[model samples]
Target: MDFTPAIKLLNSCNTVLILSHHNPDADAYGSSLGLALALRGVGKEVVVANQSGKVGRFSFIPGFAEVVDKIAVNNPELIVFCDCGELRRVGERFEQEIKTIKCSTINIDHHATNDLFGSVNLVDEHASSTCEIVYNLLRDAKIDIGKEVATALFSGISGDTGSFQYSSTTEAAFRVATELVAFGADAYFVACNLWASRSLAALKLEADVISNLKSHCGGRLVEGLITEEMYNKHGVDSSEADFIVGRLRDIKGVEVAVLFRKEDDIWRVNLRSKSTALDVSAVAAKFGGGGHKAAAAFRSKMELESFHDQVIRELMDLFEG
Candidate 1:
């Protein structure tokens, strides 16, 4: 990908506001902070801001301490949004501010559903993660590939690719991972930071969440519900509910898996599919949400059973046709 225009835009700016989506995943934080570190390396004034969700386990990634929850700069000369499929992903307040920013904007993302909502959209749907795209951009700018940058990029790749187990893990993705590793990204450190440090409470929450797994289409599609009641009972935050969805996706002969998690009266429907032939993003976009093909999500206000029925109907239609 030719990042000449994106680099020119970044080069022209003095102060830039860098951000990712709310409810950030590793790719979100990694791409946003990776770009932040790269921009800062060239003496650009950069602020890496997020709307919500604690960095949690991703704090091991460099530039974690400097991630701010709000934008402080009055008039940033440039704004770069990373790993967000939609421009409104950073929550309502941040979206409002973005509408009024009269500066060059760059949207960097790997999701196929991205809307190209930037002055320069550096979107590559085939890229394993947004961090992969960012790594190329950094390379285009002749930025140094240090341990910190490598770890940040590697973390995103590990996350979005499920440690290179997902279908999105292409040969190019592996090559990039190899390069990042050679640049001093500690394999032990990344693995430990990503999965080796699960707390006992989190383990219990995973078991509880998995216990609710329900099946549709003769077990071809499985579902799970994590209600607020369950969260309060288990004394677990919403983040603790993430692990069970992938487990559901990996079930033998299951093509799609869904997790309906209730938070503040909203059922954030998380969907996962291991089959590349299955475009989960299409289903998610129908419900006003967007993401990668294998992993996507949407939020619904309908009653749990009604929404579950709707999801089943949609998947059945897609499959039977």
Candidate 2:
């Protein structure tokens, strides 16, 4: 996708409000905060907001503390959405709030299922992550990327690509990382904080998930469940268990891994696949959710048994066909 339109739109705007998906991951916060910092450096008034508010684990990244739950800017000239596949991914509350704002919007994302909802869409499905696209945008616009901006952008790129271990890590991703490092993005600092800083409670939660793992389809499919009771037992929230699905996917002979996290009356299902043939995003879309081919998710209100059976059937169909 062309960046000219988005570059022009951003240049003309004075105040910008940036948002990302709800229950955000590293890519979401990294892309949003990186662009917000860069825009502020250029004298544009910027406010970084998310429906879920600030994530505690990401506080190491600069400007993480400044992210707000409320829209701080009044009648902003522009709104940029980063790392979101669709508008509703910002959550029901913010989705409704955004509709009241009448301004030209820019959508910057790397999700294959992006809806091109922005007035100026900069969706590049081939890019490794949204942070990679944002880096190019800043470079093309001749905006100076200082150390803080580099760290923010690098964190997102590192996160979405799974620290360059995932298949999405392209040659361009490496080149961008090299440049960001030269700009003083502390690679070691990011790695230590993201990977090595898991709390004891999180580790306990992981152990519990592993012990109760359910195998299906001859071990090609594995699923883990986390309930409110488990959270209370471990003293950790769903964010702490983000690593559980990845661990499940790492098991030998497993093609797909599923994680069911209970939140109130709904269960948020996260899906991860090791084989490209699986296309988990298609499965997610059946339940009104969308993401990349390898990683996708949706929420369900069905009873635990019914939801588990439905998901198993879907995976079985994909595997057998």
Candidate 3:
């Protein structure tokens, strides 16, 4: 879709609602809030709402404290969704709520798996981040990229690309980052706060996860488990275990890295790949999960050991095939 008409529509809407998916990551909140602030800069009444609550670490991003939840969603002239591919991922409860709306809707995302469910889908699977899409939209509409907007966009870009370490980091991403910096985005501050400020509990979880690491396929694939017992022993929550998989991926000769954590009665699998031939999202989609090619996740009903075996078998088949 040509974003021109929707940009014009945005200029006319008095009240606009911006939304992201459930358990939103940095890119989701960043893109949503960036667009919200940009719209507000042009005198549009915009609300940034997500299906879930705050993502603790990313609350440092400006406008995060003011995020509206699903309950706050009211009838509005315009609806814009960011970083979410499909309405169902936003939360099944709000899918119909979103569909029933009769106004012009805009869907912006960077996921290759996007459902293209929007009346005006601005899905760019090649873009490194949704913030990039939003940035281009604002530029195409001739909107100014002020400090707040630049900061938010930078956060989304930096966070999703793993602070520019991931393979998705392209020349365009760096060019946008440079422009955002010129617009007064504080890269150092965001980098320090988001990555360097880990709690002791998180450190302990990291150590435990590393200690339990297992390798297979001649060190090409690595796996780690952070069980409930391990969490209790370390006195840390599962959220603190978020970065453990990165450590496994750091090991030399490891092409694929996976971490399995017990969340209540379910098993959550985080998958990462360093090889272009491997599409981790394909592995994730088998179990109803979806994400980018390099990084993907899925949830399973099987027990940890059972799920571990199943995943290993599947991965072995992929490697052998």
C-alpha local distance difference test of each model: 0.85, 0.90, 0.83
Pitting candidate 1 against candidate 2, the one with the higher TM-score is: 2
In candidate 2, how many Å is residue 29 off? 0.7
Model 3's lDDT to the true fold? Answer: 0.83
Order the candidate numbers by lDDT, best to worst: 2, 1, 3
Better of 1 and 3 by lDDT: 1
For TM-score, the strongest prediction is: 2
Clashes of 2: 0
| Tens-digit lDDT string for candidate 2 (186-290) | 999999988789999999998899899999889999999999899999899778788889899999999999999997778989999997688889998998888
User: Residue pairs in steric clash, candidate 2?
Assistant: none
The better-scoring model by TM-score among 2 and 3 is 2
The model with the greater TM-score, 1 or 3, is 1
Residue-wise C-alpha lDDT for candidate 1, range 205-287, written one tens digit per residue: 77886777778788888878788888888787787667778988888988899888999898899988888678787888888
| Candidate 1: stretches off by over 4 Å | none
- Model 2 accuracy (lDDT, Cα): 0.90
Candidate 3 residue 183 Cα shift, in angstroms, is 0.7
The ten-residue window of minimal lDDT in model 3 covers 312-321
